[model samples]
Target chain A: MTGRLRALAIVLGLAALLIATVLADAARRRAARDAEASHRLLVRVIRLPDLALSSSSRWLRHPSQAEPGAALADLPAGLDVDPAGALIGPPRAVLEAGRSR
Target chain B: MRRQLALLDYAVGALGRRAGKSAALGAGLAFVVALFGAALLLTDAIRAEHERLVEEMPDLTVQRLVAGRPALIAESFADELRGLPAVRAVEPRVWGYYFFAALEANVTIVGTERADPALDAALAHGRLPREGAEVAIGEDLADHLGLRVGDAMGIPLDGDIVFSPVVGTFGGGSAIRSADLVVARPAHARRLLDVEEGWATDLAVDLTTEDEARVITRRITERLPGARVLERRLLRRTYELTFDARGGLLAFLLVPALAAFLLLAWERLSGLGDAERREIGILKAIGWATADVLAARVYESLVLSLTGAAVGIALAYAYVFWLGAPGLWGALLGWSNLRPALDLAPALDPLQALSLLGAVVVPFVAVGVVPAWRAATLDPDRAMRGAE
Candidate 1:
């Protein structure tokens, strides 16, 4: 094959390899689905919100578990904003919007 | 097919001539793709984990509101729900966060409701607590407090200290679920959390059928005027929204970077150098159709983009799944002192990857072809002269 054809082949091959890696990773995860059973039991035993975002304030750490009425009671610490903080409006807007119910 | 291959060959050769520019474009594109791909994948994985964790949550959680803040509810409320139709059980739970001044972090203390074999199976180091004074703590908490099984730790509540021996520690797949958790007997938990007698944190309502959850939620609200009934589905929805919003915010913050990438790609493709102009002129003079010239340019763009995207995606996958997403994890999830293991289950959707590729390649190819089209229509002689 010419140099140009060789280059094309290499590019295509690289792409295929990457996609195969992803698929293989997915398969590994599927095989480990039983691992989640323990997590389910843990959840039932102690029904705290997810620990993924617990590194911040109590309200921000467990937004789903936090009181909804106090959603905008305090300002989030700088750079400690969790996803729940973003989904809930900012404090000023939340106050201005008032109660919806 | 032969004609297309010939065009592709020419495009590859041309790219080789401008190797430096091609490499720069490819690297920039790869970085942008990696950022977006990793964010998308991490968000989806975390969401899936949340769903799995919440799957076993109670059908409805009832909390009392005292001036818009969560306060302890009377255990009598559980009795009110127990008599409702299709209601299976109403469990009054005792749980709250205890601020440990030693680490300046709050640890969750959950009171176990019953003696179950499942709790024993979930422990990584030892068995569940058999007594009120014995407790099970999370792995992170255990590590921080330097406590092992049979070791006692002091938790201060209201100027007094309550000591509980660590009977077990939670780890492995359940690490994310119990990273800052402490499981204790109901009496010990209430003492550690300073809860008053006859009051509980919340009521977990289980139903015979999940279909009755909405109706039960309504009845609970009507019967208990100041109660906040949180359904499992609503909590799941909140988790889903939180993940989506987190990922979306990260992507939004990178908008300027994406725009810069687009500008760079457009400049590289549209602002062809003298050599490129002359090459196109020669091709046109040699009876290469305008369509042929454009096809060759499109091919060049495709080759670079496809290669860049593939490399970026692979790097992203390794960065998140293998490397544990060092810097990006804290950024996507909250940067907390006590964080879950985040051993997120890998979930790569083919459609999501395809959409990312399309988001990058479609605009790139379009940018490349427009400039090539403009240059292709030039007079052959003027083009050979390297005219703009």
Candidate 2:
């Protein structure tokens, strides 16, 4: 290819690539946000209360069988998930009265 | 200096002769520069905004951590805080997430019955919400919800809905205030959330002085176990660290791509094929001084790299300030959905840009010199014969 023509091609390619990268990134971010909304909608709003109620009744029927936190036994509340002692906000958040929070 | 300038002119002509390679390399490098520089500057601007907001934030906020989760605190905590010497006022703030089923997104609902001096300072278009069941929302929220001043807003309640009168809509100096914010009286918020008379989401403590934040926080935790105390300074630090960590992650992700570009650039500039080496040899055979040869090569590198840096810096400005950085801003802020149309103030200094340019220019010039010099020093007769 001629030098000027090759240069034009490279410029066009670079512009296209950058534009594509930006659009794709934006789309991916939007999809991610939508996914998060759906997750929150499903878990927090739709099914959580029903699940809690169902679990509450199950334990009530079998009163003899109970955990230390009896109400918690029915509360699946991440029974399938591992609970970690990770605080959500600032690391400097007070952990104790005189310590970090 | 005159001689160097002449060689630089010659270098420009020479680069023009190889316009295809030069344009390709320069443009690609510019793209890389734009990506990295934009990320740095955007991160800086957002960090600055966070710092500004933190300055206005209350000194200390105390939250209840019940069963390893945040829950409501009793109003009785306010009396406990009033005993502290440094404490000026303890406000039991009633604020929580309200899932706007219509919008299908969460909007923060804040309620303060008292005359908030802070809100008054920022009160631009209208007054703060005064009476019970009165709400002063953000202008954007007002527009989105299709509500006007004096219009009543119907909030969904248990079996029956409660309507609150829209007293005012805030604008100007409200960048930190989200468009989805719904500010109301504490009584209305309590009624909306079904919170009992003595319950609150958290307590906001206004200290007599800034220095007393930590001491008062310590006292609060001592008085109340499982209470999380957040200081504005600490929150500011957290924001700085979070942005820094995100920038670090971005840099890490881009390293491979950056390295690949550098490698390709090095190979192109330093790796001379047979014809190019012969041309260098002919220049040497024709009695060109070693310094002159080196100057020409260095000038060529400078032209391309500097152009790249300049283009990069310009693009970065447009991205962060004008177009709002499309996908990148969301990544930096971690708020995917709620990024309204924001015109970010660029916090980039000329010195910072120059420093970045210096860092970029050095590598290009340094990398090109060695190979060009090596070719220049070749034995004249052998070089002409293509006998490297």
Candidate 3:
């Protein structure tokens, strides 16, 4: 009976340890993946203004003098640009002037 | 009455003999209780240390925001902030997060004036990082990364890579906050992060009293329209939330310690045979009240619980301080050379001790009370005959 009890205790202890280990690994993996995604998002967002500034030349020479549809299309995935928004007003003005030409 | 007292004395003495089953039970109970106490003490000590570290941070912080995003305040803002009546010291700092390849971890890089007294006080080793590429890392980070003074670390910064020489290390009480912090010159952090003439972070004004934080914060908010000003206490509370988020993992790690304790308690209780039950019944049958039997059992449980708690606390201290439980440090703390921070001073106060005692005793009593009461209320004749 004592031997059996000892064996049972050992098994229970091992099971508990295994469960804890698996949970910790899962949490670590989840955190790592989330961190990677957040890092990628930040990098993508910060690069947007630079992309907009560089793409202005192509639209400026067009005779229509309207914001080029391709300029808006070049925006990164999941980013929406509203021409009427105040935050992007200055940049939109440049685009509008190019479209008017 | 005299015979009963003698029987009690005999029962106590029987616990001392190596051949006696009572002795084995007593020893096992004592061992388990000791471990329990140690665990409580160690956990409390770690908690107390964390609290102390949070208290030591600046009372108010004024940081600059760029386009609603956080950016380093310019050094010029320090001059503007210093002139304010409510402001104490405008400690302009440059700090950013960077990854270190050798450690395979991200570290916070802090840049401050080396001559500044407040910043200098935090240094634990050789000297503050003087040159552009020189760095001073946190004590916990250095230990984990196996870094020493003069070791060149490759710092991955935004738009640039820099090899910074580690000149020193310093300890902070918090495990989460203190880990992997590198201190450097303001120019270094600015150049690395590719921010021209801008500080990355600002710790505004150390106030005379904590009460002045809100007023000062409001003043700063009014002054710098886009800047974020936070009271130090509020910032600490935010850090505390982060700490608590990780606490679930720490609590999970303690399951083994708790399970061992419950099993020991169960084993001790299960060992009280029918013979002992009949003896207890006989006492009740003669003249002993239910309250008296209950009181004695409670006293016994109290003895075991208190002993266990005390021992556990001591063992935990030894594990953290003297002997150092290397296994626990690695598994739980994620760092091996973690010494108990100076801020951590866990006292054996009556309230804390009592709480530990209550935690152990109340649960055990809840489990044992009904069985003990049933044993005490059994008919003495039937108990003696070993009948159900």
Candidate 4:
């Protein structure tokens, strides 16, 4: 009976912690939402379309705002693998196979 | 229901009997969970912030392409774009990267007309950039150079050095946008960035209607053969792809470690020790059914896995949101030496959390129980003898 009670307590404790984490995250979301207006104003004042990642190249730092054609060309020389291509490879393969058939 | 509780009780006590081994397994599992959980949390928060903030981004940005490289477009380009039917306003922007040789880092310098009223809210100290060569800088930049208001620093521009005064520092909600940034007037920016007076970096064009983006983009491309137009939707897609690719890469790197841990777990659980085998034999001899014995093993696995996952997730949340994810931040964000204080908005996706827990727990419970099942179904006498 003691062991069973202890087991019940452990399970309840874990569940409570999970609930607390969720509630905390909710509170943080609310806080971020409240500050949205100020961030918007900053964006207008700064006049930049992307985050300040502070990389060597503008294309690397501001991928979203970079010239679309130049962005692909300006990737760091050693990093030959295309991240987007790598991610979509399997799905693209399946689609190509279907099309070929 | 009552029988299940009795089985759970036995499982808990049994785990306690082998406290060292159980604790080691729990600790290892928790670390793996925490690593993956932190990466997910940070990625989600950054993506959410990007999406939220991008609502204010300009409709279209026009840049001149010189041999496939982005070059300065004429200030007159804004005037030409303003004449378009769908164009509402066009602002010529001046901004460029400045390489600081001493620190071996690049600083982004932007040219603004004057201090916008919106800036007063983000200013940590002093006044905005006004008068000759006065500049407002980001907090991280200020900290790196150890510059305060009323201080002057000489910036090396071309063969000559241009000395500028630190008029103000930006902080608070603006840190993410302004870190490693320097804002100066167009004249000062042109002199420092070496951009010609009549030329601007690019044109930020705002459209009358969001639906007109496609039409304007087509017109702009037609008008300027060498022009590269960046639409807001394309920018949003770029951000999504960047974050997803980075997150996916990190998760991929962790796959081998996860697989090794799973293998280790299988080895430890499946190769049941002599004492464990004998204990299972005694339970079966005492009229405990194979189902009862199997139930106890499943309960033990559940208890360990759930507890480890909960603790790991809690640690990850605190690591990311509270402590700012110390060691992991620099590696993930690709920052070296000086880094902005990453104040990410906290985010927790319940579905993501459940999937992570399920990924760990299901394999663990299966690996742990299958061997216990074999032991439970064995003849009681044979099992005891085999163990001896």
Models 1 onward score TM values of 0.91, 0.73, 0.62, 0.88
Output the worst ten-in-a-row residue range by lDDT, candidate 4 chain B. Answer: B330-339
Lowest lDDT sum, 10 consecutive residues, model 1 chain B, at: B330-339
Identify the runs in model 4 with alpha carbons over 4 angstroms from their true place: A1-3, A7-15, A18-26, A29-38, A67-101, B333-337
Rank by TM-score, descending? 1, 4, 2, 3
Candidate 1's residue-wise lDDT over B1-388, tens digit each?
8888899999999889889988998899889899888888888887776776676778888888788778899998788889999999889999887666666566777888654875687778887777868999888888888999989987765566678888889888778777888898898888777788788999988899988989998898899887878777767766766667766777677778778899988887788888888888999999999999999998999998988998888888888888889888765444456776568787776787888888887888888899889989999899989887
Candidate 2 local lDDT, B1-388, one digit each (tens): 6676567667776788788988888887788788778877776665554454345455777878778666789999799889899888888878665655444334556677645444454343455677878887666666767888889887766656678898766544343344555677788878876678899877777888989888888888898998877676665555566557655666566767667877788888777777777777888888888888888898888777876766776677667765878877554433223334554444554565676666566876787788888888888677777765
TM-score for the A-chain in each candidate structure: 0.53, 0.37, 0.36, 0.47
Chain A of model 2 scored by TM-score? 0.37
* Native contact fraction, candidates in order: 0.46, 0.00, 0.00, 0.29
lDDT by residue for model 3 (B119-167), tens: 4444556566777678777677777767888787665454355688888
TM-score winner between candidates 3 and 4:
4
- The 0-to-1 C-alpha lDDT of every candidate, in the order given, reads 0.78, 0.62, 0.50, 0.76
Residue B373 miss distance in model 4 (angstroms) = 1.8
Question: How many angstroms is residue B100 displaced in model 3 relative to the true structure, after the best TM-score fit?
Answer: 1.5
RMSD of each: 5.5, 12.6, 16.1, 8.2
- What's the alpha carbon RMSD for model 3? 16.1
